[model samples]
Target: MLTGLNVAVIGGDARQLEVIRKLTELDAKLFLIGFDQLDHGFTGASKVKLDEVQFKEIDAIILPIPGTNHEGIIDTVFSNEEVKLTEDLVKSTPPHCVIYSGITNAYLDKIVQSTDRKLIQLFERDDVAIYNSIPTVEGTIMMVIQHTDITIHGSKIAVLGLGRVGMSVARTFSALGANVKVGARDTAHIARITEMGLTPFYLDAIQKEVEDIDVCINTIPHLIVTAQVISKMPAHTLIVDLASKPGGTDFRYAEKRGIKALLAPGLPGIVAPKTAGQIIANVLSQLLHDLVKERKGSSQ
Candidate 1:
């Protein structure tokens, strides 16, 4: 049991609830900041305000998946409150305190660096991303089925980028009998796509290649699907962009042409909160256990 540890879970959604519950089950004294709007409550976790002094007692802090905004404000969805994750907050954190968040912004990173605080981004963890890919792919397939009249079998599918999510999207679509064509600039990725029995094309030709696409899934975070790319696609084509907010697709052009475009990020948490939370909980448990062992070893 994590008896003496104090974990502050601040500003998150339904998935964060799972993290809080699992932390409580682990016997850690949990302080949930900005969860006042949450209807259901955990047994052991206590709710607290977002003041600097109160946030100081926390030995560890957990922020939501997308940690903060460009303006450095952390959205507490449960409380309907927006708290500025300021430098003051970072400075107030205990020296031993470690911050766990999925993604961090430039301002947040600057604060952490200046304060000498430790930050662990869970999304960057290989195990978390790899496991989460399953739910993401499943949710994506569900979206594909719901948004279009076309069947996955014999569909002309274009998967942009060959990263973790891209590879998963392509492989799954291929397995469902779609003629998968992956767009990538990397030579290795092109080779890998070919080895996986999928066609690979360079980004320079994406505009022409997207002509008859039934479904285009973009996993790249950048703006790969520009106005030119969208203009070439058939109006019946469905674009599923799995990238983070302000996704890779040209939503303006898609809407202008009456094309169906869906941005489905955080699929794991939205589609399967329980499983998603458990995945995070399991990883957190291992990390905390290792940290405890390291502390004991250093003291000895």
Candidate 2:
């Protein structure tokens, strides 16, 4: 139980609700920031302005999956209020306070470094990324079905990258009887794709691979699918770029070529918020428990 722990949850969508519920159930005193428009509240959580939170009492701070933008402006769906995460706010927190976010950018990293606060990025963990792949694959299937006239059973699909999410996406599509070809630069990943009974190709050969592919799903965050690569694909092909914002695919080129392209960043949150939330909450609960033990040990 996080009996005497004080946690501050700041700015998030439906996924944050599960984190709040789990923390509150563990008896953590929670100061909720950016939840003004929320219709309901948790028993142990209280909505408060950022300025009103007792930073000295906070043991942990939870940020939304998207975290803060480059300007430190938090993205919140629950409130109309604009909450900016400043270095001063973080510096005010106690020395033991740890900040948590799904992901972090250079700006967020800078703030944490300057404040000398510990920042944990949940998405960087293997367990989190692997589990997140499930919902992403489901969402990808949904997008393909909704946008395409062809069935997945006999479609020629190309999945770029063999990371945690990439591997899952490739496996699922192949299992559905699609002719899945995975693109990877790593020799080990290439061999693994072959071992999985899927075709494997070098990323540099992407142009040749997409020529006849019915669907091209890119997991690489880089610009692998450039205008030149998109030019080689069939006009009826569908492109699903699952990387972060401004995905790998050339959206403008795909549009000019009349090929349908979609940039889906947070598919898990969009398609299965409850499951995604539970994944995050479970991991966070474990982290908090460890924190409790560490605190006790340090004091002794």
Candidate 3:
């Protein structure tokens, strides 16, 4: 049990409720930063205002995935309160305090380094990424079926990137009898796509490969689908971008060209919050148990 630790869960969506519940069950005293809207009457946790004063005794800090904004403003989807995770706020934490988040950018990393604190990125773990891909792919399929008029069988499909999500998308699409073609920068990935009995094309030649793709799924986080690429696609093509915010496709251009393009970032939370929450909770429990073991070992 996390008997003496003070854990602060700052902000997140529905999945965060599971994290908070699990942490509370572990006997960790939780200080909720921004959850005024949720009055689920959780017994062990108390809501606290986000201010410089609250940093006095926090043993650990947990933030939502994508933690803070580029401007360092932290958004709590469960509440209306706004908290700025400023450099000053970070520097005030105790030396032993650890910051846990899903993904961190260079800006947040700089602040953590400057404060001489450790930051744990949970999303970097292979298990998390692989397990998370299940929901992501499922959500993508759900979106495709919901938006498209044509059946997936015998349709020409183009999937960009051969990463975890892309591979899953390709395999699932292929299983449903779609002629799946994957675009990738790596020769190894392209070869793997072919080995799986699917057509592979170089990402540079993606436009040339797909002239009448029924459904195009982009897993790459950057702007891979430009106007030139969209112009090459059939007007009825449905583009699903599963990347982070400001996804890979040119939304404005797709709209202007009358192509059905969708930017889906957090599908797990939207489609299956319970499953997503459990995935996060399972990982978090293991981490806390490991921390307990480490503490016990040092004491012995």
- Best-fitting candidate, scored by lDDT: 2
Best by TM-score: 2
**Model 3, position 209: C-alpha lDDT score:** 78
Q: What clash pairs does model 1 have?
A: none
Candidate achieving higher TM-score, 1 or 2? 2
lDDT of each: 0.86, 0.94, 0.85
TM-score between candidate 3 and the true structure = 0.93
Relative to the unseen true structure, what is the C-alpha lDDT of residue 18 in candidate 1, on a scale of 0 to 100? 79
The deviation in Å at residue 132 for candidate 3 is 0.9
Local accuracy of candidate 2 as per-residue lDDT tens digits, 52-155: 98798899999999889999999889999999999999998889999999999999999999999999999999999999999999999999999999899999
Model 3 regions lying over 4 Å from their true place: 52-54, 293-300
The candidate 3 region of ten consecutive residues with least summed lDDT is 51-60
What 10-residue stretch in candidate 1 is worst by lDDT?
48-57
Q: Once all C-alphas are superposed, what RMSD does model 2 give against the true structure?
A: 0.8
Each prediction's Cα RMSD? 1.7, 0.8, 1.9
TM-score of each: 0.94, 0.99, 0.93
**Arranged by lDDT, best first:** 2, 1, 3
